[model samples]
Target: MVFALGNCALSGQIPIWLQNCRKLQVLDLSWNHLNGSIPPWIGQMDNLFYLDFSNNSLTGEIPKSLTELKSLISGSSSSSNHTTALGIPLYVKRNQSANGLQYNQASSFPPSIYLSNNRINGTICPEIGQLKQLHVLDLSRNVITGSIPSSISDMGNLEVLDLSSNNLYGSIPASFNKLTFLSKFSVANNHLQGAIPTGGQFLSFPGSSFEGNPGLCGTIDSPCRAINNMGIQPAISSGSNSKFGRSSIFGITISVGVAIAVLVAIVMLKMSRRGVGDVVEDLDEETGRPHRLSEALGYSKLVLFQNSECKDLTVAELLKSTGNFNQANIIGCGGFGLVYKANLPNGVKAAVKRLSGDCGQMEREFQAEVEALSRAQHRNLVSLQGYCQHGNDRLLIYLYMENGSLDYWLHERVDGGSLLRWDTRLKIAQGAGHGLAYLHKEPNIIHRDIKTSNILLDEKFEAHLADFGLSRLLHPYDTHVTTDLVGTLGYIPPEYSQTLTATFKGDVYSFGVVLLELLTGRRPVEVCKGKNCRDLVSWVFQMKYEKREEEIFDSLIWNKNYEKQLLDVLGVACKCLDQDPRRRPSIDQVVLWLDGVGTEGTKE
Candidate 1:
């Protein structure tokens, strides 16, 4: 599966050459900087099972050719199988046998087509009805206009349908009552009017699904009215009659048989009572929250800082914005949990961090942490917007960085052009240092995890220190905080392994490793000349002692023009990496030195 190409700074249109990859099954190009209209040839791929083009600059009408995929159309069985571009098999062909047990040949998950969060304008193509096997279809957060298509009811297997945040007007098609398999449906934030459909899955959906559209009526609060001279009110149904035949006699026998089976089931249940309680308890403990929590924990009430656009946010809104925390919305993952790209109801965007594990004193500690972090704000620090707590699960919402993490720009080589220039690098380091200095000034605050991945970048590539989940708030009288070692493997200070304590010096050591990463364009741990893994600090010092400083620095910035500034930062890095914590310079001192380096770069 091709997943998460988002924030990779990939520009231009979808490459036409991709159409040649006939075996491609899953294609995800979400959250990228790609522009231009989607190529129609995408629908020509016979084996394509999933396609996502969300959160891009793509425009124009969705190609009607998408309906041509045979696998997506009902009654058409494809004998072919396909693998992803990486040569990983995604589907296997089933052989036809005369006397062998045969399973249904259709895809179990159902094909999904997502084209949300784009500039794609125009009416949704009526040809969409041809994709009868589609399970999920999302066209939300776009500029698409026109009436809601009644043809969508043709998709019998559709389970999730999102058409929110659009300008579509007119009554929701009453034909939607035929979608019995739909579990999640939303047409919120549209101009649609008339009576909402009743029956089938519509009965179970919450009012939020129909929110934002004031004209629409039926389930929520809007009154129903006649449309196009037809009565729009829900029709009351009367009971119907049926005739009994030989099949009725068989039904009577089946009723008696079911009664006997119920008796047998009760006896079996009584005999297995010794272990039944334990199994039920284990299930409850494992899931932690009930299955209905997704339904009950509507968007948590948002308590963002003033001037933020998400004043009207709630837990239900958060769930809907992130597609119920769908894997497709994941932008990053950490030891605690995953972070999702959350789009607020007011069209503002943010990042929502879902923490793993269970609740203990967390409910109390969570409030304290929020209070402290919210108070400790700086230009170089990421803003903690708000949080959500439901049962044992907790979520921390923050600002969404457009440029992603520094690790990605440095290691993944995603940012296009020479974006990682020496001057920019100096500015980033200085900003991060300033943030560290600001945090250290607080009452015994120690950021236990300080790595490039935790250092996020805004659209301008300015560094923002984040991910303070492992941070310890020391008492006013305490010298250090004793805590379990928690940090990325390569960035963790060596002394931390034995001391089992977190200190400002430890944060300085980790920052030094980040400086080395910036200078050398090398990871904290990498294979050396002998093909053996060596830490960056040892490798850099070894090269320095041997009079090969030029060889250890990033080739892109290793020039006489930049040697002076580079060497000065290298000196600071060496001081920060001192084996003894006492010898390490304070974060405040480091910040001053970095500011000097940045000033020197600006002068030249």
Candidate 2:
């Protein structure tokens, strides 16, 4: 009943809470920057069945206790919280080797082991042979050196043996013939030197598992032929025999024999779907390139991120914080959700965004929105601390913004100039500009609804852009065509009135209107000439071009001494309102302009 924590940028040592999961059965914490040695105490969790802790920076000797666990899956795991610890992810169980191989029948726990993907360097403790109930042994992707202990043959119930991606050196033990229960085996990317097992389950695996081991000659792809003149090409038919049978409730083994007793088996399971080697190419975000990787050797199984999926807050914990959505606690309301301030258990401050009433098939939309926005991790953008998805309800938890929102800073009375200083305003503007620009780049994240209301501020007036409900994830294959009007009036690009979709140009158009709001202290929509202009766009167009550039300033913001600088900033804003979407500057271009790049026309 365990869930995965998936991939995260988390680093540092493993948390204490993980090793002491008394009621826990499954734990996963993989694909992170976690460092340090594996904690030995985790081996005490007797109830665990699936454990993963891989792709980390952990170092030290592999604990002998790991082999004691009776049931363990072959995968990766490690919590994704970065710190300066000397140890981190390494999921192992009590090894039943010579040190503690003395089996106490009274200790009838069903836990498994998973302690690969670390900096651990040492020999496989021969004591590992004592665990009679061991089902899966994975010592892959590590620095564990030395020969494979022949005692491993005692694992009569072992189904998977992955010693791939390691520095283990030695001949494949002849004792592997005793592992009749083995399947899904791999020993790829290692420095092992010797002959792979010939008969029994050893011949079922493909050639990829033995690729890097130069000295190892196998029945599978090597200059050296199989022992006893057997073929080197792997046999596909061996795994189809009685070894992988499933027992039926009626005391019959449902393998090829039993199925043949009924009717002939029609077809074999697709080979590629259940990978025995490298299957597909994937892009690594950090490297910005493609790398070969297998989908998984097993089902939607254990990975590293599952560890955080634990310690999650409950629906009740959320409901109590906002006082059941009381009006006094409410900060703002949006199209698809409402924001509320809440004080939760342990004095944690949180802002909860509750989604609008359930839209039947919108779960994918909800998931997409959360996943997209959650990926943006920067100091300028508001941090999404956590989230909750209960049945029909969707809630997002954000780190509290202390300075309230930009809407208040603008519209609310700046009674004393102290409330919103000129220096702070400039800083806020620069920060907002940078955040918006990042959203416009490759795999461009379009913040479809960018307005002052969505511009939030924290203590010290550090601006953080928030509210990404209408965000879109743009990629190369995207046609960028959609029939939906986004953004507040005036902020919407004039070009968008016809296109009815979002684009980087539309964002620039909106940013221009926001800039105008800063200059003129006017709402996007206001009255002019006894006719409602509907928004600022139409009015600003008139003031800037109709021999009236100086008039477009909010009086308080327009100190006579700063006149030239103000006009220069406003001119940049004016160009952003280009009638043609393509003419608008990109976010990076906007930043350079703000930084005084190509400013001949901006100065007097």
Candidate 3:
């Protein structure tokens, strides 16, 4: 039997009559205005496997009886035909539905307990570990206090354990490293301290999982400092045993002398080579990369969106995955930072962009912009997985693109031009346009930088716009005014030099340069004729004026069959590169024009 009345706006305490439901398997009273402590008699139901009293005004300690549920402790499987046998419609919210739906069996739900977002107090019963089959245990957003029970490590099947936003204190149990199956873990916003346990699943958890605890250390950003003279004896008393004290003083003098000599020798050696001393202070000996130590040690922050695929990602694991951002793993570089290809422990690949600049003052603004970017999702845009801020370093994690950037295909590779057929190139242009159009919509996000290299291609050759919103995130500039310019030199709009501001039309102008690259096999700025240099936009305009447009198309991709479509796209590109920003077409209009290029019976 299942009795679910979640979000029903029910009032007062839990009903006493619920005890009569002797065979109840699920009891959900979440998201109601219910108050008072949970009745201990509810645990008498041996068949109960799912219990939820979340989002309530409940007070008092978590009843120990709840941990003694026989069904959870013994891992008893529910009857497959329980719903059918009762002939009653049972509403359940499982993987199939976020809202409650009629289910044929109560067994579909996991054996779990949710008592979060309440006023529950007191220590968690250590016997909670007895529920060996419980898959989730959320006690977050509460006033719960006391150290976490070490016995929780015995919960072999536990997957999600959230105890965040609580008043809990003390060090995390080192034995928790034994929970190999634990995947999602968080103790954030607590009073926890000491070195975070390493090994097993703990190594996979990101620093965000331990954020808000100022006392925590031993992670990649927060290296633990060794305690000096940890167990050494105090100074010897002088009143008694002068001979013994002298003996002790002689021994201590000899030890101190030898230690001072060793230190002097090390200092002298370091002084002999300043580079060696610098490397020792800043670089990790294992990875030979800069260490993640921050000036404000415990305050380094990392935020991973819940939708991120790398839920178990950690800074340490990311370093290990990318060989400490090794130069050999570098896939791309731009005005922002170097992008390294990271092969995560779970077999998922990602692009780790180590952002450049002093981000100490822009922490709040940077986090806000990144959070907004995380919410902006589109099929043709590279997803922002997460971000980390340690010292002056800022890193943004993105979904890895398999085929690399369009710039590599157009100019870097010797034979890359031949591989991108006319149809494929047109497809990439349309996809990038759609992504830009979406960004220009409500809550108006202007991609201050757009170029061939910023456009990434996936396994299917579909284009995904990358580095969007980063120009504003990293640089201290606004839409209306700026002292410094941000964007590739070749892609900067003419109006930007005068107005010193970024706009949607400026983005369109940059996209036009990318379109020119796709149409004509040339860099945005390249040497034209004998020792003369010109931008692609001006050269294209000059060729059009002289009626030499045919000579402007890439010799490798130009074909008699694609002449009409190529000419139509060239017209669109010219409009986007208009000298006046106001004359340039909006991204939406550009998308419509690109969509029409190959749809009018044009062949590849």
> Which candidate has the top score in TM-score?
1
How much does candidate 1 score in TM-score? 0.51
Error of 1 at 492 (Å): 1.4
Candidate 1 residues 1-604, lDDT tens each?
Answer: 2333544568899998888887565676766778899888988877676677887899988888887876577423343332112322222111122121111221222378888888989898787888876778989989889988789999876878999999898888889988766767899999887688886667667788898977667863444655478656422212243234556757966998999899968953653342332121111112223333333443233345554446656556766778777656778766556788988888878988877532333343355456556657888888887666553467787889998888867765423214788988888899999998998896457888899988999989899998876677777777788765456656778787677778889999999999998998776754111222136888888888889888878877777888889988998898899999999999998888888873553221
Ranking by TM-score: 1, 3, 2
In model 3, the number of clashes is 0
Candidate 1 lDDT:
0.71
- TM-scores for every candidate against the unseen true structure: 0.51, 0.47, 0.49
How much lDDT does candidate 2 score? 0.60
Q: Rank the candidates by lDDT, best first.
A: 3, 1, 2
lDDT of 2 by residue, 50-76 (tens): 566766687888776665543332211
The lowest-lDDT stretch of 10 consecutive residues in candidate 2 is 98-107
> Cα lDDT of all candidates, in order?
0.71, 0.60, 0.74
Q: Which residue segments of model 3 deviate by more than 4 Å?
A: 1-300, 360-372, 469-483, 527-533, 600-604
> Can you give the lDDT of residue 130 in candidate 3?
93
